[model samples]
Target: MLSIVPRHYFLGFIPLAAGAELITVFGVVNKASGIYGLLSIFTGHPITAAQLVLNIISLILLPVFLYALHSVRRQQALPVVAFSYVYFLDMLANLAFTIYFSVTWFRVFDATATAEAGKGTASSLDTASERGLSITIIVLALLFKVYFCFVLFGYARMLVRKAGLRSDNGEGKYMKQLQFIMLAIAPSFWRRGGRRAGKGRMVNTLEEGIEMY
Candidate 1:
């Protein structure tokens, strides 16, 4: 089911594309002089904008990363399931951020002032609305970041374990390589699978599949 050379490099760009969507959403907030103003001071744009740019960079490097992952996967990498779970968490985090931003923006913009008018009653109302929305996004982002960090650390541990396994395995050259690759980024696949880690039984079941394979 796997190919030595990926059938399409575009698949590697999926994360980047998703990141771009986030940038677009953030742009809306930036134009309104919301959190983007504060973010621009440090990141040259809002955090969301920075993330979008980083995503583009990641997209450019995805092919190489995927190749490396393919190599690892073929070797039956370690912490396979756990690593995949982390990637899944990362994607979900991004999606959650997007949804939260979108909803908050809509809430802020509903029946606000027009884009024209430089300074007036309408402008003040718009600013107030934007500020409220910004606060909400900030809080949500922090919460998500904390949750995501936990997942990231867990995934990192799995990756470290997988790396150790690679040294021990000596068979199935191509398969082992593919296995390693899959484990390396297995979190992304797990996220795509839409499975939750909250359920202990389900998590265990998924981990078993990763271990057995």
Candidate 2:
């Protein structure tokens, strides 16, 4: 029999792939607009556009991160489990942020654009519709991410339990017993002791009777 890749893995990959494309495509396509828009987010001043390219490239790593994360099949120890959890969180947060930014970038318009276009117009309604669709995509991506997060948690815990239940690869060796200064403390030794005590008392009583005579 042949084994097949499960459906859930495919489902999980889709969102991550979508996010990777969204960020890198825009960041590169609008390179002239300056990737440095992100600098304003960080130090309150925009840096060179060259710096932004790195940020855009970083977003492309999300799918790779997701693939790497999904590849962690087992945790050999408790700390591995913890690491897996943190890894999953980082990946999820990265992907979610990308999805959020993509939605705003493609579906939303600025106040100036909206005001100039005027309300009740076809463009405004189209923007609103696109925003709604983007929101739906975001929600679906979130749900998929949340599901996989729980799956990783459960798998990590299972790995921990399996690790705990595992038998150690211990070596069994025998050595000469140490000769104790004390007598052997086995039950047979105690039984012999009781009999010897009775015999000693009998001998003492006989000696006493002979003296009394």
Tens digits of per-residue lDDT for model 1 on 1-213? Answer: 111212222134433223322322333233334333445557755466645553544444344334434433443234333333434454565567566766666665644544434435566666677768776886787665444333333333334444544322524887567546654453333222213432665778999999999
TM-score of each: 0.29, 0.39
In model 2, the clashing pairs are none
Total clashing pairs in model 2 = 0
Candidate with the greatest lDDT versus the true structure:
2
Clashes of each: 24, 0
Please give, for residues 123-204, the per-residue lDDT of candidate 2 as tens digits: 7667678668877887787666555454444444344345432222212332112111111222122222334755786899
lDDT of each: 0.45, 0.45
Residue 22 miss distance in model 2 (angstroms): 21
User: Candidate 2, residue 123: CA error in Å?
Assistant: 4.1
Pick the TM-score winner: 2
Model 2 scores what on Cα lDDT? 0.45
